[model samples]
Target chain A: MIETEHLQKKYGDLVAVKDLSFKVESGQIWGLLGPNAAGKTTTMRILTGFLPATSGKAAVAGYDVFEQAEEVKKEIGYLPETVPLYPEMTVEAYLSFVAEIKQVPKTRKKAAIDRAIEISGLAAVRKRLIKNISRGYRQRLGLAQALIHNPKVIILDEPTIGLDPAQIVEIRQLIKSLRGEHTVLLSTHILAEVTQVCDGVVIINEGQLMSAGRLDELTSAYREKDGVYLRLKKIDNEILNLFRQLPGIDGAAQEGEEIRLEWDRNTDRREEVIKFCLDKQLGLLEMRSLALTIEELYLRIVSGGVEQ
Target chain B: MKAIRSIIKKEVLSYFSSPIAYIVIFTFLLLSGFFFYSLVSWFNSVSVQLAQNPYYYQQININQMVFSPFFNNLSIVLLLMLPLLSMRLFSEEKKMGTEELLFTSPLSVTQIITGKYLACLLILLIMLVLSAIPAALTFIYGNPELVPFLLGYLGLFLLGAAFLGIGIFWSSITENQIVSAVLTFGTLLLFWVLSWVGYSAHGLWQSVLNYLSFFEHFDSLTKGIFDTTDLVYYLSFAFFGLFLTHSVIQSRRWR
Candidate 1:
């Protein structure tokens, strides 16, 4: 579990993280969605106890980041935006070192390292120096270091960056497997990754929380006011005018042979419109409801507003 | 403490894995031997009486021809060698962004700094050990005083520790290891040559500057006297460097 209240971090004239507040519950994956310079990395660093917040309080795993940093650090494993690795060290050696520093029990250190290497799909390159490995392997090695101690909360920043599509899918599956075992919070600009892997999304922009909720919830909340798209077979303009004259049917637009109906949200006229169409015997070719997408909702929130 | 030990082992292992440790030891041994040989040549040319009191004469002989010149030359070598060992300790981590890993770990700042200091001390210890061969060779033709050799070696090790402390601190303040190396060497050279100016000054300035002289305390060690005050001075200097280094790391998180 993690929470921050009115957290602020300012660097001279520029505010890195504003007075932002959010909470992440146990057994859920929270995606921190933000573009570059959105204070995502800054927030992660503060929560991991690497940097101090300018004001307010943050706690990870019930430990205060500023006051009880050691306890907080022990509870959270952080993979920074740029995975800090010793290139000269072998994958196994680096993981072993991370295990030692993270204070994994002596008896379980090797086992933990092996499990981390396995989960990151680094078994084959365990003995090879990190510098000799490809970038994809290097990224996996960084993930392995973060997972070596199996901390309760795993914070990954752009975990899927620079990987091939297949590697990205493997990493996404790997992160998905960590859902209930650890409270996972990952930051990325990749919207698809969030939709696929995270249970909840927190959108941040310019050091402020733009939107935070479930994926479907955001789309539903931002759905169009009142509209139904319909394609009718050989419908005359007189019938269309009659439908438009009906109460609640504020307007209608034609696209090729299809018709789209727009109505006021205050009334429902779908049944009446259907009855009228049936009575007129105008055949309905195709009909479907429309709703905004999560991507659209996210863009709306981040870029000022969504227009219908 | 566990964190410190882990860091020390890793750093030492890294040194041995590379050619750094061997190169530093070889260079130290080779230079000390050259200085010792030069001292023997000077003694023979001057026809200094050595049969009656080989050990005392050897001390006197070394004082006139070896100690100052050797320390001066050795100081230059140390100034060059020590930075290479300490420069990468923090700067490399900073450059590679691994400082995030260490900073986010449960280890305290004190533990991190002490770990690095201990690692640098280990490298200096190896250099001192290899330099002992030249001291042992002195016993081949003269009755060498083991006490003075031990004292002088301790002095060199402590001096190296102090320089290393400075070097590590400098390294932590920058991401450029080359800049760290240059700054560390410059600082050590300043400390190493200050004694000459102190000895040349007049009146109260002499006393005040003498107290600041790094070489004066070390010279006492070469004279077979392990002065507690000098030991305390070196320890305090080393502690000061570590303290500054810890603060530098702490402040870096803000930046």
Candidate 2:
């Protein structure tokens, strides 16, 4: 539904997006994960046909952003970083105006506005002026306007920024409900948001693509070794040595009260370790497999520890 | 066409929803009414004196004594007031970040510009119509030439359109409404004073400057002379302002 190839955008001597390439399949939720100033907003603006790229190409819904901007615009909905709204307009009036500009047919305009209002949970405050609404409702109204036209592709820049915890959860749930219906490309610096709401992620830093893939695939691909963490009571050097001497147990180290055991990727030594702990009279409190999380993966990629 | 209509509707609604439209219209009507009252009183006094002498009575035409100066004063009032109307057309969008909504939508820049221009023009039209209430009173008391009175209004509308064009262009180039209003006032004031400056020049310089001055073109129209040159000048000046607005907006997208 959305694709970009070597999409570079330069503001005079400063490069905002550098040769960035990514693709989003139909009906899939993909997160553009990056820190601030990572060119996420610039990429989105180019895709939405708001800004002309200095070089390269981007297409949304099979329409080239540069050559066929009107068509592309008709096929996509965009919510910019700051929700653009007229404070003087009522919520319903604002949505109606967006539907009109988005070219919703007159016969169905009312229905469209109602559906957007319903989806964004704006039914109660539809008649209230925008300036009088709270911040959370304003954000929802922004989303409602973007969804007013029911475009094939929806691009949101920092959709959850500046929201309270409850509002953030509500917005994430709203986005998750959109899965398999509309192809969503939302950018955010929050790692947990991507992990919770997106099927895949394209991580970038400093205007460069660091990594891109499904959540599980990325975690496994970045894993260096198979390991398990065990918390056992009454731990001692003698028992630690005995555990390290076991077959397939390549390394064992004590991290405070817990024991970290490393082994070959294909080995399952957890059972053996549990048995060993029982025999040694060390009370095993808890045991779990050690795997890289999306948070760690994001941190590793953004901190320049890994190159992809 | 539908897109332009929608934008126009929204612009008009926004103008009315705020206090700006009512304030501008009220102030314009009050000022124009005051001018009409003072001018008519002076004309009545002069005509009474001239009634004693047939020769002086011939010199006391109401069009020259009242309507011409009335139209000129309204033009200056428009010059001051039209900037307030156009200052927020584009600059407020930029300030409130609604330019993103406008630019990202399917509407072209031309459609957006036309919608806003016509909306402001509509307000100017409404003000002109209301100011005629006092002018219409002239018909009740004295016989004023109909053609020059209407032509004077045409000239004011054209002049207002030109001022709006310049104001919209300046609004497009900045995000600050005050800056847009000030720049528009400065540019319009320069054009208003150009003929005064031209009086000191000689030969070709004099003709060129006078021709370029908006006041010179407006002067002939209020005097009841209909010339295509003045029409073309105001229309082309308006077109030139809109053209510059288009270029500035389009260029900013690239930057």
Candidate 3:
């Protein structure tokens, strides 16, 4: 639904986005993950046709962003980094206005507004002024604004920036509900939101693309080479030495009662280790494959490598 | 059409929902009303004195006195007030970050500009209507010729609209509403008084400055002369102002 080809954007001496290339498959929930000033919002603005790239190309819904901005805009609904809203308007009025600007047909405008209000859980405050609403409601209103026309592609920039935990969960749940129905490209510094809601992530830092892939693939790819962690009831210097000598185990480290076993990637070591442990009558308390958290993975990806 | 209408509707609604619209309109009406009363009082004094003089040799044209002072005062009022109406059109959107919503929507830049320009023009239209209460009262008290009066009102509309276009352009280039308002005032004042500069110069320089003076062109219309040149000048000036505004807005996309 979205693609950028070596996209670059510069503000005089500062480059906001540089040689960014990524593709969001149709109906996929893609997270644009980066810390502050990572060009996430810049990339989104370019894709939404608000800002033209200094060089290269971007397309959303098969429409070129620069060449066919209006078509691209019609296909994508964007919620900017700040929830751009008319605070003086009531919730219902705001949504209705968004519907009109989004080109929802006059006949179905009411229905569209209702659906957005319903989806964003804004029914009770429908007639309340936006300025009087809480931050959570305002965030929901921003989501509703983006959803008013039911565009195929929805780009949300830092949608949950100032929300509480509950509100963040609600917003994440709302984004989850959009999966498979809309191509959602959302940017956030919150790794938790990305881990919980995004199917894939495009990680960037310093205006350059660092990594882009499925969440699982990227996480495991960046997972430390710890191999596996094990807590055994029966552990000693001799057993640790034995583990080091095992067929699949490349090395072993025992810290008192706990043990970390490193092994070759190709081997099925769990069953072998289990059989060996059974033969040796060793007490195996717990064994699990180790992986890095999304935060750690993102930090490593963004900090450790030169962007490709 | 629908896009522009949506923008216009949003803009007009915002204007009413906020106190700024009422404040601006009230101030304009109050000021225009005061000017109207003072002009009428002076005109009435002159007419009554002339009527008492049975041997008066010179004719006191009530129509000329009625329109010239009224419209001239109105032109100054519009020069002062129209900027307030146009100041918020683009500057507020920029300041509040709502320009993102406008620019990212399917609406083109032209739609946004035209919508805002139309909304500002509508506010100016309302101010004109409110200012006309004094003139409407004149019709009830005495007979005032309609054609020249109507033509004078048209001139005010054109002059106000052209100033609004300039104001819109100025507003687009800045995010501070007060700054936009003050700059608009300065620019319009320059054009309103540019003919004074023509007084010190000679030949082409004088004519050039005079031609650029909005007051010089509007004065003809106020005198009941509907020259195509004046009409074309205002229209083209307004058009060029909008064109520059479009360029400014469009250029921001690159930055």
What are the RMSDs of all candidates, in order? Answer: 3.4, 1.5, 1.9
Q: A119, model 1: CA deviation in Å?
A: 1.1
Q: Which tens-of-lDDT digit does each residue in B47-141 have in candidate 2?
A: 89889999989878898889999999999999999999999999999989899999999999999999999999999999999999889988998
Positional deviation of residue A127's Cα in model 1 after best superposition, in angstroms: 0.6
- Per-residue alpha-carbon lDDT of model 2 for A55-123, expressed as tens digits? 999989999999999999999999999999999999999999999999999999999999999999999
Off by over 4 Å in 3: A223-226, A234-236, A254-257, A305-308, B55-58
Candidate 3, CAPRI quality class derived from DockQ:
high
Docking class of 2: high
Better of 1 and 2 by lDDT: 2
Candidate no. 2 TM-score: 0.97
Question: Which consecutive 10 residues in model 3 chain B have the weakest lDDT in total?
Answer: B54-63
Q: Report, for every candidate in turn, its global Cα lDDT versus the true structure.
A: 0.83, 0.93, 0.87
Clashes in model 1: which pairs?
none
Better of 1 and 2 by DockQ: 2
Candidate 1 TM-score, C-alpha based: 0.90
Chain A only: TM-score per candidate: 0.87, 0.95, 0.95
lDDT of 3 by residue, A38-80 (tens): 8988898889888889999898999999898888888888889
Write the number of the candidate with greater DockQ, choosing between 2 and 3: 2
Best candidate (score: TM-score): 2
Candidate 3's residue-wise lDDT over B86-109, tens digit each?
A: 888889989988899989988889
- DockQ scores of all models, one per candidate: 0.70, 0.89, 0.80
